[model samples]
Target: MKKLTGVMAQALTIDEPVVLTGTAPHGILVCDGGSLDLRGGVDDRLTIEPGGYVLLSGSCQATVSIHEGGLLEVAGTLSGAVSRNDGELWAMSGSCIHGRTLSAAGFFIDLEADATPQEDAPRFRLTGTGHDLGIAD
Candidate 1:
């Protein structure tokens, strides 16, 4: 179990799969020069760099900022809501089981109130081929 405390790491390299479980108190996990494989069940807040791919596998929540020319892929089930402050959020056409993103990249304009709770329970945005939401072309 690797843990990062209040520190600013740069040029980090992840040869194998890395799992960030604990919390970073007032710290920033920056990947200045390296490739990070974000596993599932990630429940933390961190800043991702350009060309960085954050793959969600389980229940996770984070305030991610995807810089210009960055790619954040949300794979598997996102138990919690994924809020992309900016940039592109790519989702599989036939993927995602029981979850929903607060906003997607290059499509959503409003971020302040995108995930406002309209129902009693947390809304899960999962569908099979864009049929659940009746969004078709």
Candidate 2:
């Protein structure tokens, strides 16, 4: 597990599975073809390069851009503008997002379990072109 403060390097390449926690605003250029498990409160602009995989399990308030071949899986709370250009974005159950706008040009998958919405549960938004975007029956 790695703890991140203010300011991060433009590119980050991880080999093994790792968890990263952000303490402040920052930007990440690429994950460098690694699996990244991210958590914490981030309020800034985030960019994922091609072949980067990111899983969000905390609260994020930033504009996110997923480049070609990048993958973003959300299981928490996300609030901001999201743009996916030939990438993938997945919003799982128990995750919520209050996005200003979502522009996707690749793949968007929304998975949901059969359950009622809680009062303080997360919400997700899907817009633009995609293949799969609906509740699973």
Candidate 3:
């Protein structure tokens, strides 16, 4: 597990697939349409602001927490959990997630109808404070 901390530049782009684990105390900022490929264990408390995109390819196990003004976009295959506190999440079509729990306090858009949780799948919760939470299919 690779541990990471501090702020990531807005222009940073990771083209290769890597496994990362740790906490971004100050959060992560990936702007200018930056993209990253992550695989393996990622247990981090961070924020991915707008224009930041992360691709979870292959088999990925992670627990990510996104703060306000953050966005989490998913592609490929992902397994584990994700929570957004007044942020946004776009789970793209053609993506398959197993053993995953998605909780949002803001916006959650599931591009694929199949993204709906199965009987045995993890729960998806929406709890927003004073804000009208939106969930789209």
Candidate 4:
């Protein structure tokens, strides 16, 4: 596993494993065959390509896109507008996401208790295309 701090993968491309620290840029792109350990926040978007995997322990301010065959394990908060993950998403207890019951593929989501103070209306739609992005460009 390679360690990359501060910087993240842009919309260009990558095919290896890298770890990032601190506040990553707005747009992050993780290409196929790549592995990313993101320990920061995304102000815009994060996209995981097919065959790509990401372990994000940060915050998202916009959207997150996980393509087919992609997998995301989040241990942070997603306070973004709306996101579309057409892949797998895994979230652990104490994590926070507006899409508490968001389901696009196979995933285990455990949102914070405070997310739903009471019985939700039971129908909420997340709009916009996934905010996917970062570096290599």
Better of 1 and 2 by lDDT: 2
The predictions' CA RMSDs to the true structure, in order, are 10.8, 7.8, 9.8, 9.2
lDDT of 4: 0.59
- In the range 78-99, model 2's lDDT, one tens digit per residue, is 6756755457776654565563
Judged by lDDT, which candidate is best? Answer: 4
Candidate-wise lDDT, in order = 0.38, 0.56, 0.41, 0.59
lDDT of 4 at 100: 55
Residue-level lDDT of model 1, residues 17-119, one tens digit each, is: 3554333333224353433444434434545565555544333344445554444444443333333434444443322423433333212222242243222
Per-residue CA lDDT of model 3 for 1-137, tens digit only, reads 23333333332223232243322222333443454444332433333555555544333344454455545555545444555445665544344444332433223334444454333332232333223323453
Model 4 C-alpha lDDT per residue in residues 1-137, reported as the tens digit of each score: 77766655454244699776756565677888998877777667677889998776677665677787888775656666436667776554445555453322322255435542122222222223433211111
Better of 1 and 3 by TM-score: 1
Best by TM-score: 4
Q: Rank by lDDT, descending?
A: 4, 2, 3, 1
- For candidate 1, report its TM-score: 0.43
- Models 1 onward score TM values of 0.43, 0.61, 0.40, 0.64
Candidate 3: Cα lDDT at 119? 31
Predicted candidate 2: what Cα RMSD to the true structure? 7.8
